[model samples]
Target: MSDLYDNLKRTVEDLAAPADEQEAMLRKARVGPDELALDFDAFAAAALNLVESGELSSEAYEAVRALDAHLVAFSGANNAAEWTEDALYHSSNWATARELASKVLSLMG
Candidate 1:
């Protein structure tokens, strides 16, 4: 399997480890609050590699799909929030979208 697949497998396994260990492992991998956004191009390249290699099982693929969906929603909400804050004078819709996006981004971390 590719290194990306190996890394993903290890991360998934680490997530399933004992509670304390899992927490520690996650903490190590987690990006800081200020660095929550991923480089979607890089993410897509890695994901495509996994798919092309058939390294991801169906369950893993499903999880990846869910992650992708979350990323998209989070990005949209984030952009909306930024626009509202910078140009729209903090509209309620922008605030609400930002709040929701923050929650989703937190899950990724």
Candidate 2:
């Protein structure tokens, strides 16, 4: 249970991070812009699984779901290549994602 919480916390924190830090963390994990949406989807799946198994609250699940929706939409509008660390500073989409992620992080806590 602690491990599950910890993992979810870490993922939300990553999403909640500033653009530069999020890019850095993703780069460190070898996850580039092309895979960013997939990463978010994975987070949603994990959160949903926890909720279904009665390990997480509906509130947390909703938080994750909202972020997932925003990010996936953002992905559809922008080229994955534009997700580079350099481009993130110029992107409104990244800003929105970070905002939603921060909200999710706070709600999860």
Candidate 3:
């Protein structure tokens, strides 16, 4: 296990959480604004580190990659409204991200 794995685990846990729980996590991590960016960035870095280190299985790495792509797309859309705490519960992208993150966790395990 590495710090990259720990960071990835923490981020993925938050991402895999239920909407309300995830929002609580975001709020707790918030320093100013766009708090989700922090964790999302951590996830990206962790995946990259693991890939470079050859520490993760291909299947697990692909799962992480898929979730990363999904989230990156959602965030890239510039749809600020959907990122809000209230909007998260109703956002299909968030739902899919959560599902994908959970799948990644399962694959990693």
What lDDT does each candidate get? 0.43, 0.71, 0.74
Candidate whose lDDT is highest? 3
Candidate 2 lDDT, 1-109, residue by residue in tens: 6566667667667766777777777789887754555655665777777877787789878877888887767564446556677766777877777788888777776
Lowest summed lDDT over 10 consecutive residues: which window, candidate 1?
Answer: 32-41
* lDDT for each residue of candidate 3 in 11-84, tens digit (9 for 90 to 100): 78777888778777767866322455467566665686686787777788888888878877766456777667
Error of 3 at 56 (Å): 1.3
- Model 2 score (lDDT): 0.71
Model 3: residues with Cα > 4 Å off, grouped in runs: 31-34, 52-54
Tell me how candidate 3 scores on lDDT: 0.74
Instruction: Candidate 1: list runs displaced more than 4 Å.
Output: 10-31, 34-41, 76-109
